[model samples]
Target: MAQRMYIVDDDKSIRVMIKNIIEDNDLGVIIGQANDGEIAYKQISSIYPDIVLIDLLLPSLDGIEIIKKVKNEINHDMIFIMISEVSSDNMITEAYEAGIEFFISKPINVLEVVTVIKRAIESQNLRNVLNQLKNTYSIDSRKNVTAPITNSSRRNTMKIYSELGITGESGCNDLANIIEIIVNERKTNNHFNKYNMKEIYLELNKRFYSENSIKTIKAIEQRIRRTVIVALNNIANIGIEDFSNYKFEKYSSVLFDFSDIRLEMDYIRGKSKQRGKINIKTFIEGTINLLKD
Candidate 1:
């Protein structure tokens, strides 16, 4: 079934542009729209769309407020995508903390809007599947039988790294090692958000080298960074060849920041002189999320 979406931007032009994009791409049906947060909250509560594209600065309640109210009062399952011209990190972070699945900056790019919406839909679908599996297996501990799931997840992770063109890189092993360490840590502590990247790298070095030296940690970090850059180049090249390629679509914004991917694409097309920046933490966290069964 096509995803049910709602538009909640004050600008009618943006709403029209996004609605046109959704219809043209056959992405979904727009079930409702609102020019202000008050009306949006009312319509959204009544209509219960699967996804909401909302402007951050709406009259009366604002986008984040609407999300909180919907989540708290209505108890509906809705994915929110914030549309804004604001570049302030704190505001963006606040929007994320309010439960938005993604954010789109103003002066919308058609390609970006399409890509992000598709990604959001795909992520929601995956969550649904995972939830179904959890419900099926939650009955008994002995009946859990997670070996097949574990193997399948490992294969999928390896395939993603292969598609990113990192399978042959030396740091591929380091990346795999990091995933293993995180999985093990989560099994014990139930989370790994407390540790920083530097600490993770130190732990990785200690696991392999029996000692945590700065030089070893630095070397591991450099290898992983270089490998990640190579993956970025490969993704940029794939995107240049075909923007709608499956691998390009799947890994572009999920594994790295969408802005960085766009910058890399521009550099590959010779439209820009600078290359993209790499965030090891984002890459690792994204991989971990994908690895989850």
Candidate 2:
């Protein structure tokens, strides 16, 4: 069966454009459309949809309110895509907290609409598959352990770093440990600054080598830099395969500078490009945020 979708926007033009895009891309079928929040809420409450493309501002009631109401009343798996013209961080954060799967900034470009919907669909499918696997495993497993599944901080760090494709590198474990140290500093020290980064790097050196010298520190730095480069290349390769891949979409600009990521991507995709630079501080800070959040 085709995936079900509903559009909730006051702009008739946007509704038409998004409808046409959905049809053109064969991105499921539009089950309903509403120009007001109350009607949309009523429609969704009567029958749940697989996806909802909703504007932030709507008639009768606001979009965020509709999300809260529908999510509270409707007991079904649904993907909510927020449509908006404004780029306020607070609005975006609120929508995320409200459980929106994606956002489409208004004056909606056709390509952006298609890409965002496609990625959302892919993620929804992946989630369904994982749920199925979980169910099957639950039924297949006979013995139940009394201990809870606890992931150590090290393990969590490794998992996050693996998203960047650096888990297999020689210094990945050390790098993960170093990031944990940075996160700790961020949590504990109000005076933590970039100047303290050298101390953190040296601490990493202490974990690997008995004698810490300029040469060894440089070697360790080089290894880490190379590993970070490898991670960037890996994400770029994933982007080259599918630009809308959630991993690439989420981390490409967050983990590294967007310009650098784009250059690496262009090069990977056979475009003539110059050597790209990585902002180590930016990458570290981004990783720290990713871990903390």
What RMSD value applies to candidate 1? 18.5
TM-score of each: 0.48, 0.47
lDDT of 2 by residue, 1-293 (tens): 34568999999999999999999989987767899999999877644566899999999988999998766544345789999996889988998888788999988899999999999888767765553333222121234333222246656766777687666444455566576666666669843556455786787666434556766666555546655766777787788889899999888888888788888777656674353567666777777777666
Model 2 off-target regions past 4 Å?
A: 137-293
Candidate number achieving the greatest lDDT relative to the actual structure: 1
Residue 15, candidate 1: Cα error in Å is 0.6
lDDT (10s digit) by residue, model 1, range 1-293: 45768999989999999999999999987767889899899877654566899999999889999999876665545689999999999999999998898989889999999999999999767754553343222122345433322345456666779778766554666677677778777889876766788888887776544345665576666557756876777787788899999988877887889888889888767788566788888888888886763
RMSD of each: 18.5, 20.6
lDDT of 2 at 163: 80
